[model samples]
Target: MEKCWDLNQLYLSFDDPQFSKDIKTLEKRLEDMKSIPCQDVHEDNLKSYLEQFNQFQDLVEKIYAFISLTMSSDTTNQDALKYSSVIETLLASFADTQARIDRWIGQFDLSQIQDSYIQEHMYVLQEIQENNHHLLSDEGEKVLAQMKTTGSSAWLKYKDQLISSMKVSMDGKDYPLTEVLNMAYSKDKDVRKKAYEAELAAYSQVEQGVASALNAIKGEAITVTQLRGYDSVLQRTLIDSRMSQKTLDVLLETMKKALPIFERYYRLKAEHLGYFQGLPWYELYAPVVESHESYPFEKGSQFVIEQFYSFSKHLGDYAKKAVEQHWIDIYPRVGKVGGAFCHNLHCIGESRFLLNYGNEFGDTVTLGHELGHGFHGECLNQQTALNADYPMPIAETASTFCETIIKNAALKSADSTQKLFILENELCDCAQVIVDIYSRFLFESRLIERRQKGPLSVEEIKDLMLEAQKEAYGQGLDHRYLHPYMWTWKPHYYEADYAFYNFPYAFGLLLAKGLYALYQQQGPSFSEIYEKFLSLTGQMSLEDVGKSVGIDLQDAHFWQNSIDMIKDDIDLFEELLKQNS
Candidate 1:
């Protein structure tokens, strides 16, 4: 297998004639669209303007997908980084462009767009109005947007540079931070312990700078949220994510009840690792199985596709196309970034996945995971451009739902040991999304409230973190083992643009589980409803989408029921652990 992605479908080079032509045409379209008079447009003009918007969106998507996917594959590639910078510069004026659209749409009285035919577009119009409050004066918004390149974002880039280049001493040999962090997967216990120490020590080199970056980024978000009249940072996110706070409240409460279950699992693992009192942070991702086997790329790909198809032919077909059609870029090679991500390239009517494929069982799940995202995007292909971008809460619905399918199918088909490994991975990921993510939400919410008083010292931040962990995790984590520096390394905190990014993970997981539960009841025929739900997610409120499938996200019991499903897994895992012992 070639085991790499080819980018020639986009262009051989940015300097290529076709690439230059597309770039010029894109700039020309933006200018052309700006010249069109908005006041003279009636319903027909509004329709025409929206169509042109779709075309512009398509052009920009192709240009961007090419560069971003390339950059992720090789972060150090100078040309890729240059293209990344160029894309940023172009998108910097996004506020200006968006403000123009907002003003144009605002010109139309709601009655004009509320007809039965345009009802589907109500969400799009509502989103614009919701965002309009954040738009400053044209010049002001543009300048502030442009400054982002060298503002908190620049500090973020600096933090990454400092961390990546920093060296750590491990077993008398110094290594880069990336290499040191990978030691968690080592089969040797002593090596894992040493790697943990080395990784922690490496953070010291860039702690202050990263912390300052965090302060600036988070501070900027708080200031802007206040200026925009959002109740809080999380409130702003709820609006952007098309989710309700009530929904979040229910899900958070459910996680609160499930914390002890995850804690029990953690303690069992600790005993296995020969720790009596507390499991150290290094062992958080430690694998317990002794006879580990690696899956080469081919077997891994086949396994994922076969398992997914076993659950649902629609899902299996999409995964197969994703692999066969060059939509996936798999394999661990030099120059690729460390984690995995999927880009739903809506413009090209497809997606691209990037993973540092480590040949672990987890990697198989990851393929199913990213392809699930791609399939979700595929469902949205029927929608208009403006209507196809779903909010964060609903974003993970398909991905997690597909993951559920693979896990359930694997449990049915695998031997006892394989079932244990699969369940462990499922439990591990669920714990992070449910328990760990809740703690992050707690930490960030408190940080925002305290930050309103002004800049917090490092000590104040640590105290806030400690309080948050205690509140969210309860007796689950050994109080001593709770991580304090969590705010420092997690990239979600620095995405100043997207606040309260934590809750959506839980929202996505629980919501996906709820959807999967429905699938179990409805059988294969539920595929039609599932596709409809996915297609509408980009255009409907989270609440509205749930109603399509007889779900009410606002109700606490709906969430409680979904979470209880996970409790079943925990009970089974416990029984198996005890049985094995």
Candidate 2:
């Protein structure tokens, strides 16, 4: 019943004696890692280095997750802020050592290694060897790391503070920006319109500051990627994501071909909402059908747990444990970050979720999504720290898969109106992931391209966002009412290392849909295979991971099949809308 998560498992506080001891332990591990001979390629040295690296990563992750999570829920937590910087500095100091070790490992014929432990980590070793092709010199890598602590990293922190502290002025009152944004789903037309206007107006106060941060972070990304010999920021991201450019091209091509189908769904919703021109930006999440059901935290948690259990006991039990153990920090409050994210703390074999729950059916689905991420982490608990880090594209697969489970289950039990509501919700989410995400991809691509020339002014950034929205949404959104300040609030663009973070959501959704289709065909037996797929996510290439489940990542037909699944939902939603009318 607690609204806040317990971080006691990581550490009681920054001042906890164990926290200090761990910091000391981290330093000792760094020293031990530095001692590994860079010239040696023997099994003993390789094994020792891998073990030390894993232990070092585990220590850092444990410390950083606690600090970052604290800051996420309470951005003003000064201790968390301070320790965040301190830890980054320490990690930055390790860059030269890491570069040296990576260079040494890059020299080995990893296939020839016979040790079981090394073989267990062959994929990670292969990645290291591959990425080493772009590795900067030890000193150069160290300098970039040190500079980022003050450059993109500091700008990212500032951007978060600006957004988290922002308040939207509504009818004679101020609300947290997140609370106001969530009002987009309100059934009350006046409330949704006013909240949308207020939210847009509120961004002006921080728009310049946020714009500067974006330019700096993205400018840093451009410089770094160019220095590392990447052709573009997107290329660097694909490499880091362990995805092939061919796969991205095919996925994107399929999405472009399917955009008109989504646009049709949007236009239908607009007509249902009494807007003939197009769906107004504010009405994008508007509920088309009335739903009397209310889902408070407890009810929503139980609903997700039950639905998950319907899939598999292990998954259901994981959700139950997350809720019972206070793994979720629910509800919106001033200083808490907007949006929902599940942070998998592999170091502790647990995950924590942050959600601005508003008691809508959408919020319940969001809970299922985050818990699905937790379940994925649960399946990966047996892997070592180094081997547990999956790529970004695969990151959303489990979460979206869980989301599908929740929506489909709810649809089966709902009355006509409720089914319409649930189906509309699913379609709305898909449109965002596919349609809106495509806009984001375009905006970021253009932004990075422009940022390379110089810093973009606030107006320029807004213009870029609007241009991208128009192109992607086409006739789907009312051009006059489009959200121009989107680039200011989305955290995706500000991360220097994780450029082009938009398409992965689309990837996850389509892939999850494909996997769900497989589950539906195979019945109960597929649960074991699903878990095995999730378990191997950290240890294999994404293509190979898909192969494990009989899904081919490189095939255009596979992605097109997933898009068709959404098209089917759009068809059902259109039918339901006509019946309800």
TM-score to native of every candidate shown: 0.94, 0.94
Give the local distance difference test score of model 1.
0.78
In candidate 2, what are the lDDT values of residues 1-581, reduced to their tens digit? 68899999999988899999998999889888888888887988999888888888888999999999999999899999888878877877889999999999998888788899998899899989988989999999988887887899899989989998999999989998878987997889999999999999999899989999999999999999989999999999999988889889988989888999999999999999899888999999998988878899889989999988989999989999999999999999989987899999999999999999999888999999999899999999999988888999999999999999999999999988999989988899899999999999999999988888899999999999999999999998888899999987788898899899999999998999999999999998999999999999988878889999999988999999999999999999999999999
| Model 1 Cα lDDT, one tens digit per residue, 1-581 | 55767667777776778877887888888877776676674666676677788788888888877778777777687877787667666766666766776777777766656445356577787677667777777676777777776787887888777766888887789898777777887778888888887776777777777778878888888877887678788888888888887877877877888788777777777776778764676777777664356776688788888877766687788888888877677877777777888888777677888887877777877777888898999899888778898888777878888888777876886766667777877887888898789788888888888877887877778788888877766655557766666777677888877988888888889999998888889888888899889988888889999999899988888888877888898788877676656
In terms of lDDT, which candidate is strongest? 2
Assess candidate 2 and give its lDDT.
0.91
Q: Give the TM-score of candidate 1.
A: 0.94
**Backbone clashes, each candidate:** 0, 0
* Overall lDDT per candidate, in order of appearance: 0.78, 0.91
Clashing pairs in 1: none
Instruction: Supply candidate 1's per-residue lDDT for 170.
Output: 78
**Least accurate stretch of 10 residues (summed lDDT) in model 1?**
111-120
TM-score of candidate 2 on Cα atoms, chains taken together: 0.94
Deviation in angstroms for 295 in model 1? 2.5
**For every candidate, C-alpha RMSD to the true structure in Å:** 2.1, 2.3
